[model samples]
Target: MHPASAWLANESAHIEDEADEHDLHAFQAIRRMDEILVNNFMVFQDVVEEGCYDLVVGDEAWDVDYFLHENPELKRFAFAWMTDFVGWVPMPDGGEHEVALTADYNAEMIEQRARYGRVRDRSIFVGSPEDVVDLPFGPGLPGIREWTEANFDFAGYVTGFVPPTQQEREQVRRRLGYGEDDLLCVVTVGGSGVGGPLLHRVLDAVPAARRLVPGLRFLVVTGPRIDPAGLPRRRGVSYRGYLPELYRQLAACDLAVVQGGLTTCMELAAADRPFLYVPLRHHFEQNVHVRHRLERYGAGRCVDYEEACDPDALAVAMAKELHREEHAIPVETDGAQRAGEMLAELI
Candidate 1:
């Protein structure tokens, strides 16, 4: 792993907890991007020089395409996985100039790539145009194809447990020692330590929520970055370290409480589970892009971090959402296959 990975993870926690420091954090993060790109370019260059590969694929890493473009003599086909839209990001200051500022930054990057002669032979959006935040350049940006939600299968991309069957759900619950009558609420913070605050708040509301729903149980999965021992222990709530197949557990649960990250939110949506997502303040991607997609799918309920900090309010919301029936539109499960076929054509 690059040396900056650990620092970036630590910075993510700091930014998530201290919303006031967002601007400073953003500056620091942007400064580190060049270093990361350079490191990636060096490593990739070494590997490519050692082998003869037909195609280069990048999974949300722009550096891969950058390296390939820079070494155009290699004459290799490049494929890009654009997991999210790139333009129209909101500035932290929320000033009137934010739109122009973001647009200019995006335009600069596009211009740089254009100068390099369109290295990306094929690129696909992981989601439909509806899932995209309205881009300044619009969806028809050259050399990019979009996978409609109905055709963009997320089964292999996101998690193996796409939508658990009734039997699979029962087996997962049994393995977790949950009773059939118990209403299970799985709380997760994705892979970042920044979710510590949200996890603590959820733990605080457990007592009140459980009182309202007698059979309610909480399963808090402190991901790899978080130490489960650091959290408070309480009845009706079970704390566990990272689980390999967390989505399976999530799919089987009665409800889910998660951070505003797209992966976790979309996992719950695919499982058709009722969930409450708390997006970090000033997180433009989470608050704007992910929120729009979820709204389009009629998925998770959005609760602001401040409202969630109030234990009483969070408890009431949790209880209310737990029993609420969701009729979310089904996400397509064949995206990986479609993507494979597209890449196969290039080979």
Candidate 2:
């Protein structure tokens, strides 16, 4: 990782623990964003000048968009995997937190637009049109343009890798030392330590789950932020830290229990795997945006974190969902190609 990224990561490592303080974190991050950008602006400008790039592409990099807004000489293409730009996240507690963050974002965008100009020439929504709708606050606002229903024709969810074929699935299973009759359950909580509580709850349900279904094995994937050593060992349960190309492993599993992150849920949906997703409490993006899109695709069982806390209930849920029929709507896999063509037009 770059020095700046490492510094930022170290600074924000505790944010996940204080879920209710998300708004405060957002405000502070936004306040610091300009300072960070200003510090690196000259270096970035020097690099861009030397490169003479026809178009600058950014993935949820608002700072890049702001820079492009100031320097309209180069075309800008911005894409986002989430609906953060829409600024209409419905939080569990209410809209106060959402409103505060949205106001901050809007203020920044409006100020930049007045001082410079529109931040982007065109933007791509890496999701279905249903994911982007006019909420009470409205659609993409304040200097964000060319992103509406029309973008959906070319925009699609990019899963980064194709789902494995049946033969390949078997290859992965055999490589993992699983027999044909052994039922494999892969549990993950994305990259953040916020899911640590969820992982522990799932572990608590393991004994009951194995009793409900014998021959069932659990593979708890503690992502980069969580240490596998922290979780207690149990029979029929194994712990591993951060498997690369984890989507392939997900494809080969009989069932998956995951946190409500778009990328992980979408990967399981794309692989046609049975899964139960527990969205974090008070998380607007996961509870609102990701849930809407997942429901649209008829993918994954939405389990509340409170409900998942009950080991018996979670165990029963896990047993019921294991080896169930795959009925999720197919996810588009050509998004990268489509996005590439869209950018090619700008060039």
Candidate 1 global Cα RMSD: 4.6
Per-candidate clashes come to 2, 0
Which pairs clash inside model 1?
A: 153-334, 153-335
Could you give candidate 1's per-residue lDDT for residues 24-143 as a string of tens digits? 223234435666667756666666667777777677665666556667665454554445544446545656565555555555556655676566666666666566655443233322
Alpha-carbon lDDT, every model: 0.71, 0.72
| Model 2 CA deviation exceeding 4 Å by range | 1-14, 17-51, 67-85, 95-118, 138-147, 150-153
Q: After superposition, how far is residue 296 of candidate 1 from its true place, in Å?
A: 0.7
Per-residue lDDT of candidate 2, residues 1-347 (tens digit)? 32344333232354553444112233344445565665455555555656556676666665556666667665333322222234434454545665676656655655554665444545677865665544543233532233345322436788888888999999999999897899999999888677788888899999999999998998999999889999988899889999999998899999999988889999999999999999877666677777878888989999987788899999999988885675988998898787777777766
Q: After superposition, how far is residue 112 of candidate 1 from its true place, in Å?
A: 3.8
Per-model TM-score, in order, reads 0.84, 0.81
In Å, residue 155's CA in model 1 sits off its true spot by 12
